[model samples]
Target: MSAVTEGRPRSPWAAPPRPAWEGEPSKAGLAGKGLVLGIACLAVLFPLWIVIVTSLSSKKTITEAGGLVLIPKGITFIAYQELLSGGQVTRATIISILVTLVGTLFSMTVSVLCAYGLSRTSSLGHRWFLMTLLATMFFGAGLIPTYLLVQTLGLTDTYLALILPSAVSVFNILVLRGFFMGISPELIDSARIDGAGDWRILWKIVLPLSRAVVAVITLFYAVGYWSAWFNASIYLSDQDMMPLQNVMIQLVQKQEAPMGMGQAIKTGQLSELAVQMAVMVLALLPVAFLSPFVQKHFKKGMLTGAVKG
Candidate 1:
């Protein structure tokens, strides 16, 4: 190389070479890291793959495979067909969907209103309300007391039992209240000057600017409601009213399927494992499809709501 070329000054915009301490990694290190990651991925995905395969396998294949199927052969969706054809499973799935949608909407509305009211320091009993919510976070009514309260209100064996008792989350309220408090007071003042009522200001001004946190909170509540089973098991005595998650628990933990699928099981057309796996897949699909749409907001929302501005 020419001396001038070698001696040329570095451009100001050029990125500096990595320091020797952070120099290129050894092939061994790269290989080891890749190996570790690959193993971890396989470890996590292997069981999921097995579940899918087992659910898709024929009764004979499952029987031959002994238990969980690692390799899929003679794939059949009869398991899914059996589960879906059974009216009970279908009804349970519908119930779960309804609960998730209605519960999330109700919870979000209450949380938002409570948070907004609590955010205003000038509101009456603001400190007391805040303390109460925080106390609930630290302490909860025992299961017996809570059940009695639900029973006293005549919510047992009803859909209201699944929703009303756990409608508001103290943690969610605190997070949202903190977020609302972070909004510039000038914005509220400007809205007030424009003759915007508190309702209008909250709806038009606050919510639009708080979409990220709202999406995160909505997902949180939706996921919680979707996965909830203990509440249903406690409050609902009617088999027809039990949600998918509760039914799933019955199937997986107790190896029980509703009467609709029991005939197929009795006839040796479906295995208990296949039915359980099918139920898992059915429950997973909705959340899996829904997550990607809201994932973009998740990280930003959590971080922004968590950190004071």
Candidate 2:
């Protein structure tokens, strides 16, 4: 036996002492937490399960149930087939994907450059610019003014209106700026001494190290662009140009009772509860899949890069 293992008397294997801050959790407390988490998971997942099952359920089963189907009597892809058969839904999906991709790219580029520039305390008028940006977060120019501005700029009925009006999120800028500021100045100074410029250092060093925060912000921008219907509803006059969310609102938000799922599957009917659930699933699936992969960094990024000022 090693000297560390040698003792006056042999003892049974046991766990080492926990730190005071991490005292052993009581079994009841652990059980309670587990129970709470389990219930929470079920609360979130049960509705999602019902939506999926309802969407996949046979038209006869749905008609008989007259509500969300928890246990699908029979599975059918008719809902999906109807939704995607060269219809408005298909076009809207493509439009939404394009908007999300292009908007996220544009937003991230502008926000990153703006955050980097403003993070430099030495930059002239940065404080004023930052204050101006922050001020807009609390107080917005009313809808009329914003609409008139877009109109004056000839962005009405254009995709640019959906993208440009709210492209640079002030909150994301602040988060990124805080993260940039948190970086050690010594690294930047050393890079400068090695013949690197501000842009070079920012691209090569700062950005590479700030992946977690940047990814979280990018996901935020993507989700915002994907889910945004108000902008399209206000700016876009042509139904062809409207994003998926706007199309969904147009289809699902009417006060009239939805048509039957069987009618929905056959005659391009879209107002049924099953159809609505299918649309919801389609809209939610992208973000739902994307979030869990990056969720490990989400909390850390939010806490570490949260703007103190």
Candidate 3:
């Protein structure tokens, strides 16, 4: 090779050569890392694949497989249709949707406002309020006192029992505070000089610029509310008021579908396992569908909040 060719700089996109202290990886080392990553992926995806295959499998297919279907033979929507057709399951699903939507909205609103209020160093009693919030992170009232407080407020067996008690997430607020504080102070001062009120500035500038963090936090709240069943079991007594997660728990625990289960099985001739897998898919789909849209922001948003704080 020519001396000039050998002396050329490496391509910008190419990885830098390892330092002398860090010797080149052997083929075995590379293979081990690849094996570990492959196993991790399989550990997660394998169960999901099984659940989906079984959910779509025919009665004959499940019978032939002797359990969860490993390979799909033919696709079918019967399990999903059956679940959706059941009155109790349908009611529970609607309740879950309502709870997730309302809870996420309420939590986001409260967190954003609280975070913004505290982000301003000049806000009255900001430090005191922050200390109170920090204290909650270190100590909680425990289950009995919280339950008693909710009961005293006549929130038991009401949707408010789920919404009000957990409406304000101090952690989310703190993360948001970190992000908001990282905004250019001069920009905020400029808005103030332009006669913009605190509300106006937040709505017009801060929110627009902080879309990444907002989307991340919204997903966090939505997923939490959607997947929660324990809180429902504790607070809600009426069967009609149960959410989707609670209904799923009932199906798994009772080993019988409480919601038109007979008709569901008759229509599809599906096994009990098929119904359970179908419910699991329903519970998982929303988060799966939503994540891709906001995943690009997840790392950036989380790191900014952590680093700026």
Which regions in candidate 3 have their CA more than 4 angstroms from the true location? 1-32, 263-268
Question: Over the stretch 1-309, how does candidate 3's per-residue lDDT look in tens digits?
Answer: 688877998799989988965998889888998999999999999999999999998888998999999999998887888788757887888898999999999999999999999999889999999999999999999999999999999999999887888888888998899999999999999999999999999999999989999999999999999998878899999998999999889888887675677765766677788888999899899989999999998997888976785
Candidates' RMSD to native: 4.6, 6.1, 5.0
Candidate 2 structure quality by residue, lDDT tens digits, 95-211 = 999999999999999999999998899889998999999899999989999999999999999999989998998989999999999889899999999999988998999899889
The TM-score of candidate 3 is: 0.89
Candidate topping TM-score:
3
Q: Find the 10 residues in a row with the least total lDDT in model 3.
A: 258-267
Q: What tens-digit string does per-residue lDDT give for candidate 1 at 182-270?
A: 89999999999989998998999889988988998998999989988889998988999999998888899888886588888889988
CA lDDT for candidate 3: 0.89
Task: Give lDDT: candidate 1, residue 78.
Answer: 88
Error of 1 at 100 (Å): 0.9
Write down the TM-score for model 1: 0.88
Span of 10 residues, lowest total lDDT, candidate 2: 255-264
